[model samples]
Target: MIEFIITALEALALIAMAALVFNSHRNRFLNRYFALFLVFLALWVLCGFPQALVQEPSDYFITLVFRLAHCMAVLATGIFFLFGLGFYLGRAPGRTWRGSVLLATAIMAFCSLSDLIVRSVSYDQGRFYITNGTAFPLFPAFMILCGGGGLLCIALKRRESIGPDRARATYILLGFGIFLGLAILLVIVLPGIMGSDITSDYTFFLVIIPTGFTAYAILKHHLLDVRLAIRRSFAYLLTLIIFGAPIFLSYMIFRFAFESHPNLETAISIIALALAVALSPSALRWSNRIAARLFFSGLYDEVGLLHEVSSIFTSTANIREGLAAATAIICDALGLKQLQVAIPEEATRGKGNWVIGCVRREKDILGFQEVEVSASPLFLLHDPMLLDDDANAGVVEDVRNAAMLLEMRSRGIIACLPVRGPGGNVGILMVGRKVKRRALDPMDVDLLHRFCERAGLFIENYLLSSYLLSMFEELSETRKRLEESDRFKTDIINVTSHELRTPLTILNGYAFMLQDHYERFAEDERRQYLTYITASCERLNAILDQFLTVSRFQAGAIRAALKPTDLLELLAEVKAGFIPEQGRRIESDAIPLGVRVLTDRSYLLLMLKNLIENAIRFSPSEMPIIIKAEEKEREVMLSIHDFGEGIAQEELQDIFQPFTRLEEIDKHQVGTGLGLYIVRLIADLLSVTVDVESEPQEGTVFRLTLPHA
Candidate 1:
């Protein structure tokens, strides 16, 4: 009974390991061979059950099962060699190894099944045993060669491998050595030397040791690419083991102690069901916890981290501030030494190419620094990378990327995560080494990738928002300018009609009078009438010239050619352009010559003419207008001073605006309010500064400052 139970458990363990390994990575050739090896071992263990139980009448069946089990053992040895070779080389065996294995398998299989290898099987003392034929020694010799060769390959690989690879190789070596060495000792050495089968019953049970080790390596050290899937699968497997163990024990107790009493057996079965049901919830919880710890040494809530990052980006009003907060949070959560967030220069709206980052446990921020996008190739990289990995050979081969990576490594950065946008990469996330300088595990890499994906979404949204806002502001300013333009057009129409009507009316009336009454009037009367008509025509011409100058400015047809210009000569021209009555009051004697400045000659002359005309219109007829020029180290300052009816201080800037008039239109009929407006436009074109100081009663001064040539 003990033997039967042990054999059943052995078959269960072997079959379970086989299914788990095969399902974990069915696409991998090494996993397939490993699983096939376990299945054959399960078959050998299962053959034990029937061999021990079959009656004398079934001797032929027992012999067939016995021969098939030994044949399967030889096949399993061959498969193990293939698996070991693949695992050691990190790939499937080449054609040469495959052909050799096939040839060896065919020979060994023929030898195991031949009548000479297993002569016969018989039942003795309620147990089945085999009587070997003369050539059976060949079968043991083949098993020793194949199994020893597999162990030797793994032992050599363990020496060459490093880190996780070395650890996995060591486990494989220890597992296969223990299982195969003990099997040989129990199955062949003792039977041949001591003429006893004392340890034969435990031979198949030793398969569990190797399978357990492989499973550990897969779960703990990431032996295969199926780590993610195996984590959950291992959890479910543990849950089953937890829920099944007590029920199996209960059934064993009932079968041995109370099988004859049907009522007690039924009660024990019910109690076992109740116990399994009661343990299920706790069993599942513990299983998940164990799997979490086994796969990830320190498990983190990835979903929670995602939610926290999302909240930081969405809830914060400022995008840069949110990035800083997210960087700090991520650094603390991942136990990183530092985390850097690099945004594009254009995204900052011409401020700078900024890299915002933070250091672990340090309240003082690592802060932003100017790093040109061309100098740092992080912006150009589209894929996330670990700087230390050989996979980054492409990055290291390129000169720019290599220099950037070298600088990053010097700063202790381990990973370069690109925050991608629809168009391209919008930003980069540089992850520093862990707190203790530990290598980043698979889980850490996965979390950072996912975080970068979310960060990409956040950054893209901010850029979109900023773009929309700038567009909105531009639209608003355009609308305001259009409204102001509408008001300006209305003012131009009103001023043109009023100012032109007076001059045209006076000129027409005086000309008609002179033509009709030329003979009747005396010479002085006719001369005075002719002078009045000429003055009106000159006033109309001046007004038309001012309007034409403003029209050229608005049409963008006015161009200024700047060169060395004499300040005193330009002032003399301004004084000469004024009417005889206004020019007489202009005091130009105080002005000095030889002051030269960099200015457009035509535009500067127009500006000075407008200022002198403005002073003549506003000041009293009796007061003298003063024009002065001063030369400094780098510039020349020219001022036009008016002492009559000085402008109010509050209206100084208003005087520069187009169509703005402070005095009553009826009283200041000679002024069009466009003189200073023209002065402002011409000053701007020549890059000159115009300044005004005024008091309501004292006086007003218009100063022009220009840079020297």
Candidate 2:
């Protein structure tokens, strides 16, 4: 019974070790060494469980399985030593190493096939022994040579520049060192102390300590952020352990309690089995909670960090302050030494090129680095040369290079992360060494990536806010200048109207007096004086009206009063009102008499007057001004066509703006240039459409459409 218990325990341990080895094969450093460790473990278990090996014919098959498993383990150990040496030196083992591995594998294969390496093997009285063969001593020497070579390579690698990853490498080497030392001591000194015969089982226990330590380092130490797999493995093992322990204990207790009676023993076994079955659900739930807490600590921490970052982003308008808050929060949470926030430099050039906006824990004040984008020849992956001895160097260089390269290529990298929010790469967030100067583990990288991704969104939003703030400031300054200019324009209009209107009013009084009281004057002279006074008064009135309209529009007080009016009559009256002058001709066309329109009569009149007046002022003395009123379906169309030096197509759109006049026009026109602008405002309020078709030096046409009554 004791022997069976020992065999069962050893079997469980061997199975556990095999599972660990299988998992380790999927990893980098653990891949090669784990297989060998499993072999040694299996050998130890088998040596203890010799009865199981001889209990049945199937036991022979089991022994053959173990023998094959042992060979594989030995071969893996030899290869792993060479591979580990190469990894430590930061380069692959050269041709010499490959040749040695291949030669060793071939020789081991031949020995296994010929049985020459183990001359004779016999099993008697449930005890097995192996007779030493020709290559027995040589095999031990090979093992020593491989183990010693690994140590030597590790020593050489230590002499080179060691960064944050050095400590992790040290832990691995120490584990190997302990195993190697134990192996050598067992091979050389154990036989002398414990008689002539030596067995593999005695040395197996020493391997468990190093293997346990290695498993811990790989799973918990963030060795390249591979924590999830480790955590899952631990959870699986824990579940099994929790379930198996009670069963094992119950088996032992029941065996003792019913040792004297076969029937009692069967009854106790059944009861224990029933109890284990009933308690499994509770065990599973407990194990699940423990696993979740262990694996998702970073996730919980990130949720809190995201909230803090979001608050900072929304409340702050200052770009630098926002960046500082974001970077500091992330760095503190993730245990990073440095952080950088960058924006595109070519953003000012109308193309988005990235520029470093801010940096934390950097020696250079000019944190901005220009990135060159390329395609075809991709940048190296995490260049080893970039790593600096200082904790910040590797992270800084890695992040900078990654950010620049990603931005250039327009690809995303989640190199390290829980990625703060979404999965897309926002920007690179590099993490420096931990407090203990150790390299970032896989979990750390995942968490950092998540944080940076979330923080990147915040950074983008802050930058947008910053841009909007700048635009608002510019608009405010422009408004101030416009207000000042309006005041100055009002002053000029007030002074000029006062200065010109007084003379025109006095001249009109004189002309009326001359015509009424001085009848003896010549007819031609009287007529000339009357004409001069009339022209001056009209010109002055027009100027004053233009200024008033512009001032009203600028003050946002322009409104139109809509009323029904006769369109044909209004046009005829306006045509008759224009006095014929030398070298000026006015042409007018009237529509049907009943053609009526619901519009702001005053506004329509003003619009027509401005269009006619503009055509006359710009046209040559011989050019005819054509004004046509026509009735179209549901609307009245009024067109003022001018045969004059017309406007360019480009300037047509700006013609209606106040104070805007054609650059090519003669500068002697007496008008404030607000006629077209007031016309547009009046049209808009009455829901009228105004369109102009103009071609340089050909002629221009102004068309207006008002709703018909």
Candidate 3:
């Protein structure tokens, strides 16, 4: 009767778990593997029932059905591992995972079919047992590979997993770890080492526990996206209820048979039932552990977890992101409660290394506190030789160098691992005490060391790559500037040659006439010719002065001598330079007495002169060039406005560019375009700002606003 109950429950669990994955969202890779696993589990359970019945003289052809069922159960082992790989990776199984499944299933098939693993079932002590054969050892070896491999894959990705993913992985490691431990003891250790028979009754527990957890994960969805993958867990759970419901009816039938007869056989069974009821409290706890489906809550796969942490170096763009990821891995793998990471000063290229800040996990509450610290020689900790100091006597200087040291120690920081970059150590990876508050073991340190080595090199390379990219961009920009400069030089030479040739020709003609035909020529003609030569000389002198100004500024020979002077007086003088017609079109107010400024006197004058000249050239003959002055707080404004053809908005910015003459401006205009460019150079030299506002068909205004010296 007890065997019947166990068999019925196992059958229900297997069928429910199968329908849960296969019925809905079966297209999911993990679900497909899980569904396949359920099929084998159901087959094993059905076969076990017949094998157990061998005690009843005829266990439904146990020789054939029992042997195939053992093979099929081993086949489920491979499928379960594949499911885990897909579930934990949260992706489809790759070629490697698929190949492993095929290889394992093939080996199980050969051994089971050839009777090399389990030759026959034996009925003894009113129980059926599957006795091992010569090749039985090979079965456990296959189990180790599939089970260990799946777990390793989970660990490898744990660092990147978060929220539901992390929780799911944690459950898998814990639950499956218990399963593995039990399988080794029941199938390998007890049989191979103790040379005992394998009981058919206890074998179902291994499959039942993991199946329960998988069903739960599917129901919840987030841990493994139940909505996307396992939409039918509740349906399966209902099915379990439907199938296992007969167990209570059978119990009632047994109660009637035992109570009505009251024989010696029935009396022992009743006493056992009474003891079970009495010890229900302890049984409830064990049942809960079994129902919860994992012996440990947060067990970690050490090697895989370290791989997950090392991957952060290649995966994240910055130290902050990498450290955040590393923190999660550390907490999960090493069971650290709180973690603190500090970046070195040299990485930021500063006085001291900075604290990348702190992350504290109190219970499940995880948060970051950004507290920056400076100047600690903690980079020396990168050697991997340093161990935790009980009293911290050796690290007194480090504490002195960094004030946050005492606070960190108080918080139970166990080890300071240096995160090294190309330039020595980039930061400090400070870990706090373990979650269990135990000192770190050798394995923990070694894992950290390996992770840090990979992380540091990868981070250094990222920084190096970023730096190289920036330098390349800067070099490209510098090349562009040089090209523009070359173009400007070419334009200057063309304009200068044309301007110079015309003046030199005039001077040469005038000199020849005055020297050879002085007596023959009229006095007035000679005087007019002499005047032309004098004008030509002055024009040449002006051009030469412009050239000299350009050369002086370009070579950084000019310096500003700032002193208090009347800006209004200077503007009045400049306004006088541009004479007006009878109507006084060039208008101005009375010069203020104390509108003083501190600027290079000559540079300021040059700026004012250029604005007046530009205005005169662009404005029409009928319109006057206006020089307007206004007083402002802490500064004075001098405006040069032209009432003629207004400058276009698009070309306003370029007016200050050297030798930049607009096509709209009169081609017959007599001056070189260097006036405004010279003004720009002078303003920059003297620490003055020059701005312009203009519109086509309206007038242009050049405003010179300077601060008081």
Candidate 4:
């Protein structure tokens, strides 16, 4: 009867697990695999139920059923192994590995079809014996091969690629090891010692070992969201044990009594039934009490309550709410009449310091009191509130004063704790005695101290949260101002482009007309017109290019085609194209001709052109603009030196910013204020560094450091 009950419960659990797997099928792979395993386990249990009920030897029908069940279990095990391997690979069984799974499944199926796997079976005295033939060795070999395949697949995964999923693989390997070890022991070692007759019952335990491991793996790893299923199974098993055990025992007792006394059988059975019925409520209550006491002890409940209090403290933004919640928790936990928390007046007055304020409480019993001070304001002034000989003096005086006041009223202090936040001495917490003449115990003091420490953390967190919120508000306002400024800059660039283009076009047209018609005029007139037109057109084109580059960079449309090119060649091209004034000498030292670098050649050329143009525009007509290059460790350094009115120290930092030009320099040198900005942007994209050194009334040197090829 007991075996039947166990089988029934196992079956129900299996069905429930199946339903869960089907419901969560789309969500988890492990559940589907484990659910199939449970189905086979349930069938295996059912096959043994009839034999257990009859207390008889096994028959051909039962043997056939058991063999089928074993086949199912093996197939389920193999599938689970493959699924575990797939999980490690971060994919489902793909073409690369699916053949292995199919081959293993086919081998197991063929083995099941051949009777040679378990040649013969016999039973005696509730023991079933199975004789394994040569084919039996192949079964173990097949299992080992499947397990090896899983291990190999996992080993192939790159070490860096293996993430948290490695833990699931470990679980799978462990479960397989346990299952395989127990199977071998039962089939080979146990039968030799205990004889084959004892194999049937022991073999069931071997199967259970692997099943239990699989269940644990599923629960711990959430391998298919099977944790909920496991939890529900536990709950169901507990419910059955609690409600079913007493009734089952009572029924057995009544049956024994009736069989022993035939004359009084009916009466005794009725009395037993009546007693069981009468005790049902008490039995349930007792069971509930026992279970609750085991699972939900008072200490556990208290811990849970403390956790809830902690959550409230952490989640709340209001300081007053946190303080109130803390006070309530302490008062309730300690069973105190009143709890008072005080912050030091002096601590709050300082910029970022906090001191323990004074804590006050009323004495009870006709409003009379005998007050005992736990901590004082002076004690908190030391920050940590250390209770030493030197620090205790002020505390002792405050206690004396409180005692005097209490002598007039009549209430005693229970305990006092100093509260500290990150900034130190945030407050002091005090609890009054529940009854007159009662003093605080060691446990009370410990609890209060812990509560105070937690309260301190909460207060500190609150202050930090407030500070963060203020910072966020300031950042939001700053971001808004920046957005508006950027939009205004864009508008100014658009208006300037239109305004500058019209005048430049007319100037170029008239200059070109004079240069063309000057054949009938003087040679000097033609030369002057050509120079003016060329210089004006070049300046205008430079301004337009800077603006276009800046807009493209800001819009994230700039693309760099990087290749190995000589820096000297690129710089030379820029110099030859952008001719400086006649009297302004441009000089280049003998740079390494073939020093190749990997960068966008066009952007590099543009950057060098900007530097040379800026130098020539700012320097005096007769001064020389020098370009030099030298190789450093892992980098090539290039410098463009200008003998110009140098930038001021205060303005050096702002020189690279857009629309920022030297206030003391020539105002007539038409520039869009974007040349330096574009230069900096291109350098940044190439992972290069740009630095400028200058002194007032001297000269400025712009340096570029590029990674050496």
TM-scores, each model vs. reference: 0.62, 0.43, 0.53, 0.35
RMSD of 3: 15.1
Highest-scoring model, lDDT: 1
Rank ordering of all candidates by TM-score, starting from the highest: 1, 3, 2, 4
Which tens-of-lDDT digit does each residue in 1-709 have in candidate 1? Answer: 5676787787787787677677765877877888898888778877664545643537678678768878889888988888888877867999999889969887888878878688887655544466888989888888888888888888877776555666888888888899888998888787677653455667767767887887787667656534545566878888877767767976897777987898988888888888888988888878888998897655555567888988998897676677778877778777888888777676556545667767765544443444565545554455645455432433255566566677677777777878876766778888888777766654566678778887778877887888889889999999987887787788778887898889899998988888888899999998898888888989899888988998899788999888897877777787788779888998975666677889888888888877877777777889888888887899888888998677777777688888788245788777677888898899888888999888887778988899987
- lDDT per model, in order? 0.77, 0.60, 0.66, 0.62
Rank all candidate structures by their lDDT, best first, as comma-separated numbers.
1, 3, 4, 2
Candidate 4 per-residue lDDT, tens place, 90-132, comes to 5566765667676777677567645757666677666657666
**Relative to the unseen true structure, what is the C-alpha lDDT of residue 500 in candidate 4, on a scale of 0 to 100?**
71
Candidate 4 Cα deviation (angstroms), residue 519: 11
Model 3 stretches with alpha carbons more than 4 Å out: 1-345, 348-374, 378-414, 421-424, 432-451, 576-586, 589-592, 662-666
lDDT of 2 by residue, 210-320 (tens): 566555555555333334444556666777798868687879987998799999998888887887788877776677668868774542244557778778777876655
Stretch of 10 with least lDDT, candidate 3: 223-232
Residue 1's lDDT within candidate 4 is: 66
Lowest lDDT 10-mer window, candidate 1? 386-395
Give a tens-digit lDDT track for model 3, residues 1-709: 5665676688787776666556544566776777787787777766654544544645326556756766876787788778777766666878986896878687786788667877776555544556667987787787788778777776655544544445566666766677767867765566555544554446665666766666665554233233322322333343345433444455566677667566854765676567556655554444444433432333344456777877776677776667667766676666787665665545644434544433554656253535446334454344433335523433334443344455456556667777665566656677777767766643466466666666667666766776777789999998987876787688668767777877899999989988998999898998999999988998889888887898788778987888887877776666566545522555665546677887877778777777777776677767776766677778877777888678778887788887778343347536667888899898887777778888887888888888775
Model 3's alpha-carbon lDDT is: 0.66
